[model samples]
Target: MLSDLQRETRDEEIWKIKILSEMQRLKISFYFWREKTNNNLSYTSLMGPDKLKILKEFDLSAVFQSKTRAEQIRALWNQFYKLYLLMQNKTTTKKIFCHESQAWLDAFLAPSTGHPNKNNFVRGMYRTQDVTPYIHVLVNHVGEFLEIHQEFGLAAFSCSAVEKKNHMQVCLYFQNTLKDGGHENSQKSAILEMLEHENQQLYFALNETPNFFEAPKKFRLE
Candidate 1:
């Protein structure tokens, strides 16, 4: 006979496989598997949008058939989806943080008071799972940061743009700059080439004019 802990572990593994299969069927592109060399799952490609989609769409009903556990998981996911939506809030011109959303964050990070409330779901989760460092920072420090910067919202502190720029630069370097003989023939340093590429992009952007007129109706543009 299997021990209780072993059975639980087996069930969890089976559930993970089912979830992954479902996500694949749904064409969700977030990474969930461990790399060959590393035991931990790669989160480098997991962006805010991916997280929001997974939280919103990934069904926990198949994994947690128990009413109590399913309800708890749903509540937790709903809280996460709300948090992501708040973070992704944008103005007409650009991304902006809304201070009004902090109330939801506070509710999410609230301590369990032994009553039936939003905090109870998080409390139940904490009881079952180990709190990671990211969770600790989000629960404790995020609110403090928001308090310190009352004028700014969470979007102001987001690193998405920086990450995107870095990814673009890496692609440029590998595909365009370092192609022939690993940059031995080129007179310019890799850093200088990258700088030049950025300058050229900026120049083009500044020189480009916006076309205010709409395309003709019969053009059949895709």
Candidate 2:
């Protein structure tokens, strides 16, 4: 059912083209706008739904409060990445919070050892500014990840990571429009051209061997 271009390309390659590329562009632009304006702009802000049901396998209703399910997942991954970076930092002098944060990180790292999924029931923790209650958020995130892997393929995680990145781009493009004296229509076309050009340049820079995450071999695609 795949076209020649689609068939020849690996799943991750196809994912890059169809998802990551666009998401990265948009997310970058969005972050630029936020930096320039110092305002928090998000997909939920522009669009009413904080999350969207891109795929309809699991019930995300429990995790989401203000954001939609998809948005919640994006927030979770954002937190996960931030936590991951924090954990990876090998600085000499550690903060007090770092000690507590490690325990949280361990919980995320070891989701199988405890009954995190059944005990907690919060999915939309990303909507808050506080990081103290991250355990609940982490539990929801891991639960969602496992559920998604069980029902869909590992490609779904790839898809999600790409989308999370994509959220930044369109906002950045808006900032470009502001910089160009609010020529919305003309600036949009110009930005699109510029994005395509840069994308091509970056593609060659990657040396044509796109790095991809390993697929979870044990999970069956539902």
lDDT for model 1: 0.56
The regions of model 1 sitting more than 4 angstroms off are 1-13, 30-45, 86-124, 159-222
Report the CA-based lDDT of candidate 2 relative to the real structure: 0.41
On a 0 to 1 TM-score scale, where does candidate 2 land against the true structure? 0.20
Give the per-residue lDDT digits (tens) of candidate 2, residues 63-176.
223234335445445555555444333331234234544554553343223345774443322222333455654433543443444445333344556666566566555553
lDDT values, one for every candidate: 0.56, 0.41
Separate clash counts for every candidate: 0, 16
Worst 10 residues of 1 by lDDT: 91-100
Best-fitting candidate, scored by TM-score: 1
Candidate 1 lDDT by residue in tens digits, 1-222 = 012223345664665666667577667764456778867644335565665676777666655545555566577668766655654443211122233334434544446556676545423334313455666665556555655654666667866798798899889888667543454565666777788777877777798944245877776678
User: Relative to the unseen true structure, what is the Cα RMSD of model 1?
Assistant: 12.6
